[model samples]
Target chain A: MIETEHLQKKYGDLVAVKDLSFKVESGQIWGLLGPNAAGKTTTMRILTGFLPATSGKAAVAGYDVFEQAEEVKKEIGYLPETVPLYPEMTVEAYLSFVAEIKQVPKTRKKAAIDRAIEISGLAAVRKRLIKNISRGYRQRLGLAQALIHNPKVIILDEPTIGLDPAQIVEIRQLIKSLRGEHTVLLSTHILAEVTQVCDGVVIINEGQLMSAGRLDELTSAYREKDGVYLRLKKIDNEILNLFRQLPGIDGAAQEGEEIRLEWDRNTDRREEVIKFCLDKQLGLLEMRSLALTIEELYLRIVSGGVEQ
Target chain B: MKAIRSIIKKEVLSYFSSPIAYIVIFTFLLLSGFFFYSLVSWFNSVSVQLAQNPYYYQQININQMVFSPFFNNLSIVLLLMLPLLSMRLFSEEKKMGTEELLFTSPLSVTQIITGKYLACLLILLIMLVLSAIPAALTFIYGNPELVPFLLGYLGLFLLGAAFLGIGIFWSSITENQIVSAVLTFGTLLLFWVLSWVGYSAHGLWQSVLNYLSFFEHFDSLTKGIFDTTDLVYYLSFAFFGLFLTHSVIQSRRWR
Candidate 1:
């Protein structure tokens, strides 16, 4: 439901978002992954019509963000990084005000507010002033304001920034429950969140698009690093050379009695390695598949250059 | 229209939710009431003494004895009070970071500004309405002239609205409510003094500065004179301030 082409934003001599382009499909949970100062917020702001792009074009829900901003604003719910709350207002009052401003029909305003409060898990604190609530509840209240009108797309920026672990899990579960019902475009510095909750991932660094695709497709490209680790009772150059010559092995690294073999995800070098060990009479102590995590892929793409 | 109404409703709710509204209204009423009564009693003593004397033959009415000078003092009260009413219009939003909510909402810059402008105007209207309590009490002593009394209040309302417009613009330019309040008072004081400064100049320059003074138009209107030029000046002053507010808000969205 979101697309951009050469979307660039600059503040005088500083380029905040540069040559960024990505697309998010409807009803999909897409995670925008980047480090601090990586232009994720700028891109999201442009898509939400809060900030105009310095150049290029962006559209949300099929409307040009700059030209048809009001319509785009109507179709998306945005939870900014800071939560942007009126601390003096009660939770219910804030949600209802959001409902009114979002133009929810008068007949459905109460129901809409109720639905958002229920979804954000803010029923108990509905009567409490926003400033009196805990940080976790405040974050949820921010979510409630965004969801009050039930916009087609939900955009959240670092939704779990300051929350404790349990609160983070609760909020993550809440986000996960939105899958396939509403299109979600969320940005976070949490990499494991991308793997656990996102249907697709878009990795960006330094205001540039680094890598983006389905989660499995993204990790599949790094299977060469997915290998088997082994520790043997004995070590020799001849045995190391023999193991490196195995048919399924892509490469081998030996440090004293320990050996690690690298291969693609589809390769099964375990059986071959065991047979060779038996044949050579070398005692094998440990062997297991070392899976490559999205974090590693992220690090590789960020520090190892964008070629991957 | 719905957006504007929602904005005004939220602003009004917010205004009353804080002690600032009560304090502003209370100060305005107390100050105006004090001045209104003292001026009325002073006028009463003067008119009484004049009636007893044979040397004074100039005609004295309630409009001349009470409304004219009381309204001028009312303008001074407004100068002290209207800034407090409008100081938080945009500055608090900016300081609290709630402008993100306002700027990103479906409402346009014009809608947001118009809504806020009307909310501040409503506060001034409340103060004006409450000031009428003192005005109505004047009926206990003498018959107040209808046209001049009405026109004087009209002048105060217009002048207060213009000052509120300027206050909102100043609030938009900075995130400090104190700065906004002080800057508004400073600017209004500058306008107040411009007419005094016109005394030293000669010919067209002096006349032009006097015409440009905010109180000059207000003074003319309080005199029961119906001049479209005064209306034009007040309306344009308010419109220009609001237009600048809109520009400040719009420019904020870019960087």
Candidate 2:
């Protein structure tokens, strides 16, 4: 579990993280969605106890980041935006070192390292120096270091960056497997990754929380006011005018042979419109409801507003 | 403490894995031997009486021809060698962004700094050990005083520790290891040559500057006297460097 209240971090004239507040519950994956310079990395660093917040309080795993940093650090494993690795060290050696520093029990250190290497799909390159490995392997090695101690909360920043599509899918599956075992919070600009892997999304922009909720919830909340798209077979303009004259049917637009109906949200006229169409015997070719997408909702929130 | 030990082992292992440790030891041994040989040549040319009191004469002989010149030359070598060992300790981590890993770990700042200091001390210890061969060779033709050799070696090790402390601190303040190396060497050279100016000054300035002289305390060690005050001075200097280094790391998180 993690929470921050009115957290602020300012660097001279520029505010890195504003007075932002959010909470992440146990057994859920929270995606921190933000573009570059959105204070995502800054927030992660503060929560991991690497940097101090300018004001307010943050706690990870019930430990205060500023006051009880050691306890907080022990509870959270952080993979920074740029995975800090010793290139000269072998994958196994680096993981072993991370295990030692993270204070994994002596008896379980090797086992933990092996499990981390396995989960990151680094078994084959365990003995090879990190510098000799490809970038994809290097990224996996960084993930392995973060997972070596199996901390309760795993914070990954752009975990899927620079990987091939297949590697990205493997990493996404790997992160998905960590859902209930650890409270996972990952930051990325990749919207698809969030939709696929995270249970909840927190959108941040310019050091402020733009939107935070479930994926479907955001789309539903931002759905169009009142509209139904319909394609009718050989419908005359007189019938269309009659439908438009009906109460609640504020307007209608034609696209090729299809018709789209727009109505006021205050009334429902779908049944009446259907009855009228049936009575007129105008055949309905195709009909479907429309709703905004999560991507659209996210863009709306981040870029000022969504227009219908 | 566990964190410190882990860091020390890793750093030492890294040194041995590379050619750094061997190169530093070889260079130290080779230079000390050259200085010792030069001292023997000077003694023979001057026809200094050595049969009656080989050990005392050897001390006197070394004082006139070896100690100052050797320390001066050795100081230059140390100034060059020590930075290479300490420069990468923090700067490399900073450059590679691994400082995030260490900073986010449960280890305290004190533990991190002490770990690095201990690692640098280990490298200096190896250099001192290899330099002992030249001291042992002195016993081949003269009755060498083991006490003075031990004292002088301790002095060199402590001096190296102090320089290393400075070097590590400098390294932590920058991401450029080359800049760290240059700054560390410059600082050590300043400390190493200050004694000459102190000895040349007049009146109260002499006393005040003498107290600041790094070489004066070390010279006492070469004279077979392990002065507690000098030991305390070196320890305090080393502690000061570590303290500054810890603060530098702490402040870096803000930046």
Q: Largest TM-score belongs to which candidate?
A: 1
lDDT of 1 by residue, A141-222 (tens): 8888888888889999999899999999999999998888889999998988888899998888889999888888887775
lDDT of 1 by residue, B211-237 (tens): 878898888777888699888888888
DockQ of 2: 0.70
Task: Provide i-RMS per model in Å.
Answer: 1.3, 1.4
Backbone clashes counted, model 2: 0
Clashing pairs in 1: none
Q: For candidate 2, lDDT tens digit of each residue in A1-308?
A: 88999999988889999988988899899999988999999999889998888998998999889999999999888999898888778888888888999999889999999899889999899999888999889888888888889899999999999999999998999899999989999999988899899998888899998877777777766665666777777767886787788777878778667777877654566777778778878787676664565677788888978532
Residue A167 local lDDT, model 1: 96
Model 2 C-alpha lDDT per residue in residues B170-190, reported as the tens digit of each score: 998899989999998888778
The TM-score of candidate 2's chain A against the true chain A comes to 0.87
Q: Tell me the docking grade of candidate 2.
A: medium
DockQ comparisons of all candidates to the true complex: 0.71, 0.70
Write down the lDDT of every candidate, Cα atoms only. 0.86, 0.83
